[model samples]
Target: MNIIEKHLAKAADLEKVSVGEDIRCKVRLVVAHDVTGPMAVEQFAKIKIEEVFDPQRVVMVIDHIYPASTVQARNMHWILKDFTKRYGTILYEHGQGVVHQIISENHAQNYGDIIIGADSHTCTAGGYGVIGIGVGSTEVAAAMATGTIDLEVPEVVEVNLTGSFKPFVTAKDLVLTLIGRFGTDGLTDKAILFTGPGVRGLSKDERMTVSNMGIEMGAMISFFADEDKDEGVAQTVAIELSEIIPVVACPYSPANIKPVQEVAGTEVTQVVAGSCTNGRLSDMKAIAEVLRGKHIHPDVNMIVIPASARVYEEMEKHDYCKVIRDAGAVLLNPGCGPCFGAHQGLAADRDVVVSTTNRNFPGRMGSREAKIYLASPVTAAKAAVHGRFVDPREPSGGGEN
Candidate 1:
């Protein structure tokens, strides 16, 4: 059995399992956030259950649309607060951080643990060597009530990564390159198992960046395997990290990838560097490295957001946040800033944005008429300073140095 099968079998108390087989398995953790938690709580109420299956295993995060921008969002927070109070479930309130980041910092400690969340980026936990699956609010509610989830074992697509990343090239570029090779839905309903010598090249946070965007390719889950598997996979694709350059996903699709050179000089109205995708301390350092001793372009509005409060504190201790702010970037509270297009940094029609967030779908960051280019933290920071996309590796890329 492969890594997926091995974990599933252990969770299901079975000796063996097969791809495409339906099974119910116990989960170590279940997560929901403000955007989905309200809906999940609504569904849980429908189940007529008095308490959650295991309060310790259930977590609710009020990060997305946090601080209550509207009455409706505030009411949603009230729902989650009321639910958590009644059921004794753990809740990370406002200013805590993004849901996936919170989970990674707090709950994803053990390998081979089964984790499910209502948000697609829940796959971010896979960086911890756990099986992290994203599901709908209904499914999350069911999992909360029953402490188990039924799933059809997905066919595995092995991503064999080799080589090391070049300077200014990062996991975001690698994942974008993969999405470019295989269209958005190329791996629909499949599980992507990362393997090969290249897996060792990425730090845990870099691995999280890779896993966070797997859902953009329509993968059910994307995780790093503890060991290499030579068989039982539906397909295998190799990625040479050394050959990858800074790239971006063009408007309306995460798979519409292009080299930064191709899009250089395209004016951008906003630049964002925060999300489950690249909002870690390393990402902040990348942004600060470019912004230090220079302010962003007068035409560009830059927003820097940390992934968690702890990350924010570390940034302050390291002076990354101070340098970023001194460079004319607006530092917002740690949360899902402008990633879901719910609020904060909404682009106007005809606006162009370069962001470190995952997904570039129409209206993903604001108006459908606005164009969003998804890139790495370094690329996004360079764009903010240049007021357009520029190759970070080139001395002639032309930005305020």
Candidate 2:
């Protein structure tokens, strides 16, 4: 078996391994943000849970409203603070960093672990070979109480990305292209296991970009290279560390396969960059490089939001903020924001938005009539400048530095 398959088999084995015949099929790590934590705390109170199973296993982060965007947001933070303190849990405020980043680096997400977060992009942990799933606030609270959560073990579909990515074609573009090829009906109720030589060449950030969007296809979990093969049984379920060629999957049923090049040149009305999927520092740098000296087309409203204050700080430190701002892109905070249409940058009726976000389901980013096209940071930036979906490899009217 190849590296990915080997690790997956180990993950399956760990799921079956028993501690004195008490089979632990679902090993869980619970996560919640300010927006979702308040609700989770309320649910925990409802259940009358005296104490969490493991205080160290739960992570609470206040990222959706850093600078406290509103009175309601401030109250949410206050409630979260009180709740974590009562449970003797770790409460990561604005200073600790975004939930995704902190969780990725946290010791709790070791290989073969099943992690569940209230945020949809929680699957980002798959980059490290853990099976990550996004759950509702109530589900999160239950995991905190029971130390386990039930899940339907999903069938795995292998996404074989073969060829090397062309210049300007990033992991973001690969996922978007998958969505365009399969629409929203593909890969429903499946776990996407990204394979192929192409997938092995990607960085951790790039891998996160791909797995984080498994929700777009309604996938239960997305897994990549395993990291635990060398650490004996303890680390045997971790993703294999290797170079991956960037690729995306659009699993339409169990038989259909399509490539993004087949649907290039599609038109769009808006272009967005940022969001948890493509709001990392590398993603922002790619956008700045693509739109350095160019201005966004008047017809397209380009919006850029960093995933967290850490990402925002990195952009400012690297001067990426100035580059994008000067190019006429509207910048927003680190919250889920436009990805869910919770605040500004809502889509118009029947409008198509080319975004760097994960899902594009009807009404995901605003108007139910609106359509969202997922792409890489580079593609979104280029499209924003050209007023249309233009492949980043193609020359623009005025080349970006």
The TM-score values for the models, in the order shown, are 0.98, 0.79
Runs in model 2 deviating more than 4 A are 1-23, 26-28, 65-73, 95-98, 105-108, 179-186, 227-269, 350-352, 397-401
Q: Which pairs, if any, clash in model 1?
A: none
User: Tens-digit lDDT track for model 2 on 241-315?
Assistant: 222212222221211223334345556678878877888889989888877877888888888877767778889
- Least accurate stretch of 10 residues (summed lDDT) in model 2? 228-237
Model 1 earns a TM-score of 0.98
The lDDT for every candidate, in the order shown, is 0.89, 0.69
The candidate that achieves the highest TM-score relative to the unseen native structure: 1
Model 1 ranges with Cα > 4 A deviation:
398-401
Q: Roughly what TM-score does model 2 have, to 2 decimal places?
A: 0.79
